[model samples]
Target: MEKAKAFLDKLTEEEHERVSRLPFKNDFKFYEDFALLGMHVDLVKPGLVSCSFKVPPRLTDGNGNLASGAIANLVDEVGAAVIYVEGLPMNVSVDMSMSYLSTAKLHDELEITSRLLGRKGGYSGTLVLIKNKTTGEVIAEGRHSLFGKPASKM
Candidate 1:
């Protein structure tokens, strides 16, 4: 328990520093950390979140393309934003999968579109597409499944 508490304290400190360095803040404080990666939420409707992000050099793979993990992170985070905007309980991701269609090189401006596919009971499904804004080339696509807490817990 002591170790876990120490770890949480360290994580919180790191997140605080990261948030302080953000160029812009968003309505979601937890998601605001992504701003350091140059991600901006262009729209957030009931079950959708449209975002614009630039592939920074630091997030590149060995081949100088956007990292798959980075894309997956974007997908997962945006999907969570979609759920949050829907007045649902903050959920835990049960599964997430991504398919790489093409490569996005450093400095590429990518558009990320995420929408909640559906919500049944306490479960939610979401999909995200990452594409090059100029060419409409798909960079990656992903799906996420999450289970929200019961309403009584919210």
Candidate 2:
């Protein structure tokens, strides 16, 4: 909780107000409070999701480019959101891989599209593409495999 408090302490007045207004408070607190990903879920369907957010300065690397870890966090969280929409039980990531094609600078508007590849008895695969919203340039691609607990088990 110290980290969350410390991060909150550094937020500008406007940013603090924006964070305070987040609807899904408990659900995305880590991403919003720590990762500083201003995520907004635009659409969600059974097997697909579309999200958009800006890369906050706090998420950038020393060179002022979006950090790889931040990109991975977005990919992972967005994929999990897709799984949740598909009526799957809570899941754990079994495997994940990312391919970086381009870079996004701090505050870049990013569009993330995630699609579920297929679901087997206990596992599902997902693919995601992250692109620059204005230029439509692909920045990264990600693949994730998740293992879901059975509804009965849950």
Model 2, residue 66: distance off in Å is: 0.6
lDDT of 1 by residue, 45-152 (tens): 888889898888777889999888888788878877787733545798999999999999988899999988998877889999999998999999999998986454
lDDT score, candidate 1? 0.82
Q: Which runs of model 2 end up more than 4 angstroms from their true locations?
A: 1-33, 85-89, 151-154
Candidate 2 has an lDDT of 0.84
| Residue 154 lDDT (model 1) | 41
Query: Which regions in candidate 1 have their CA more than 4 angstroms from the true location?
Result: 1-36, 85-89, 152-154
lDDT of each: 0.82, 0.84
Q: Candidate 1 clashing pairs?
A: none
